[model samples]
Target: METDKRNLGGRPGITVQDVQRACEALRKQGRTIGPTNIRLELGRGSYSTIIRALRNLGLSASSKHKGGE
Candidate 1:
């Protein structure tokens, strides 16, 4: 299987600050802060890339859902 270039290469240009800013903007607008939403807000970033950024920001998806289905 061919590896996805986006996920197999060097560090993505996206920064934690960028993710934080996007999340803050979305929060102010009462929007959900998921990977898809963050990617849309960024205009450029893969799912994994956004997830990593979110992780760096200490806002990983797993951290949101706790002790429930």
Candidate 2:
């Protein structure tokens, strides 16, 4: 997936892989998977950028934990 190339706060780019990793971690912790949680997990990226990456992974803010009810 093509990630946002623009730099933010002097940090590197936020890639789909990054978001996927963050989401997985959040899932393991039973945490709410959203832009705010994700940003806190990664310590970077904008809400819009995180949202786009989550969409690419077929996930949303309201997504459930894998194999969970």
Estimated TM-score per prediction? Answer: 0.69, 0.73
Q: How many residue pairs clash in each candidate?
A: 0, 0
lDDT agreement of model 1 with the native? 0.66
Per-candidate Cα lDDT values, in order, are 0.66, 0.77
Stretches of model 1 off by over 4 angstroms after superposition: 1-12, 62-69
Candidate 2 lDDT, 1-69, residue by residue in tens: 244333332356787888888988988898888899999999988888888877778887667675573
Model 1 CA RMSD to the hidden true structure, in angstroms: 8.4
How far residue 42's Cα lies from its native spot in candidate 1, in Å, is 0.8
Query: How much is 29 displaced in model 2, in angstroms?
Result: 0.7
Cα misplacement distance, residue 43 of candidate 2 (Å)? 0.2
